[model samples]
Structure formats: structure tokens, C-alpha cells
Target: MNDPKLTPQALWHCALGLLSRRDHSRLELSQKLRQRQFDVELIEQALDKLEQQQWLSDHRFAVVQVRQHIFKKHGPLRIRMELKRKGVNEAYIEQALAEEDPDWFELALVCYQSRFRNRDIPDIKEKAKRMRYLQSRGFNSDQIRYALEAEQD
Candidate 1:
């Protein structure tokens, strides 16, 4: 079997196709290109071109990712970890999170309510389980407390 030849144009096209589908951090895009067996130099050149044209940006990617994860009911902690995994810089991640300005307590409450709409007030064991669930969803202790206390309000 013959391996396909990778060209600069081909790399650019592939990057563009991925970007068209969703915002990708620079590192994510590079990893995808590398996985497809593209040359390092070609991938760099194509990414640079995309950056120059403003078609690719880690800041934009981080912002979009934060919003998407928030919509999915993930807390800022989880979102920040995800962004870090995607290779976004700390500054961009902080900027994006700050700009979004999500009310963590309110968001946690909504997420908790939606997840346990039909369940009765949790007993001690059940409360522990629910607390673990919310924590895994990236909420802090205070946010989780606020969410679990909704019944008392």
C-alpha cells in the first residue's frame, strides 16, 4: 500500500475543514495534522497562515469551548481543565472565563435541579452521592452546597 503524499495545500485544506466544523486550539489542530502524517514544517506553515487570516485562534477556541461546556452544565473548574487539556494558554483561558462571567451558584443550582428533578430530598447517603456527582461536574464545595440547599429555600 502506498502512503498518500502530504502537501502544504492539502494540510491547509484539512485544517480548514476541521476549523469549519468547530473551533480548535492551535495545539489540537497541530495534533490532528500530525496524526494524519503531515510534515511538521507543513503543518506549522499552514497553521501560521490560518492564524494570520484569523481563521484559527486559541483565544477564540477557549471562549467558544467555555460557552459550549457551560451550556452542557459543566462548571468553570471542569471547563478550565478541559481548556488546559486542549493546550490553551492560561492567560487565554482566564480571559475567556472572566469574560463569560457565569454565576456559578446559579448554574450549579440549575444543573442540580435538572439532574434530580424527580428524586425526593436526598437522605445522608443519597446526599453524599449527589454531592459527588456535582463535584465531578466541576463545581466547588460552595457551589455544590448552594445547589443542594435549594430545597430549603
Candidate 2:
């Protein structure tokens, strides 16, 4: 690692290279640069440059993150909190989440069925277990309940 005191440009280049490989939230990119001992001011400048060039965008980050995380079987609540932790703005998160259709509950149920196929547990116990699993994945209580009941029907 170049000395933080002497190589701001090198640090920026390195960070940009890393970022070019994937989308990174501001906080995430900051933490990565910090681990290399880059000065905070220098890191911020690099990040600002990237943003000005449109190479870094929180809006794009939020959209891609939500899409990718949901595809991995994560629930919306979990995805939302994770995006917040990654430093995505609240307004963007809310807007993206709002645009998502409410019919996702049925999709979630389908996912659960696919994953747990071929095993038949008793209804009450099964619903409880399913609820816990979905809740841990970040679904709200209502969504989880609805999915569980729909499974029974």
C-alpha cells in the first residue's frame, strides 16, 4: 500500500479500479479506502470525482442491490435494511421499494414451496417454522402470515 500521505492519486486509481468491477455504496467504498489507510479527505475527493463523472451513483446502487438481493431469496425488509447499512439514501430506498408490486407475497410463497418441496410437516408447526424462516429473511409479519396461510389453502 502506498503511504496515505504521499499517494492520493494512486489510491484513487486503485479504488476506482476496484469499483469498476462492481457497484459500491459510498460507505462501502469509504471503508475499503480507509482499510488501506487513505486519508479521509483524499478518499472523499476521489469519491466526489467518481460521482461527478457518473461512475458512482447511489440510485443505481440501490436499484441493482434490491434486484440482486431479492433474486437471492432475501425478503424486502432484509434487503431494505442491508441497503441502508450500505449507505444508500432513504428516499431512494423508499422509492424503489414502493415501486415494487404487492403481489410479491405469492412469489415468496412459491419460493418457499420450491425450497421445502417433498417434505410434509404438520400445518401448525409448519406455519410457525415457515414464519420464522421468512421473518429472518426480512419479510414483515403480515407478509409471512399471508404466505403461510396461502400455503395451507
**How well does each candidate superpose onto the true structure, as a TM-score?**
0.93, 0.88
Candidate 2 lDDT by residue in tens digits, 38-142: 878988999999999988888888888887877777788888899999999999897777765446686577667766774455777766787788888877877
Model 1 lDDT on a 0 to 1 scale: 0.90
lDDT for model 2, please. 0.79
Q: Relative to the true structure, how large is the alpha-carbon lDDT of every model?
A: 0.90, 0.79
Error of 2 at 17 (Å): 1.1
Could you tell me the TM-score of candidate 2? 0.88
Q: Write the per-residue lDDT of candidate 1 for residues 1-153, one digit (tens) a residue.
A: 134557776778899999999989999999999999999988888899899999999999999999999999999889999999999999999999999989999999889988887556657888898889999999999999999887557
List where candidate 2 sits over 4 angstroms from the true fold.
1-6, 99-102
Tell me which residue pairs clash in candidate 2.
none
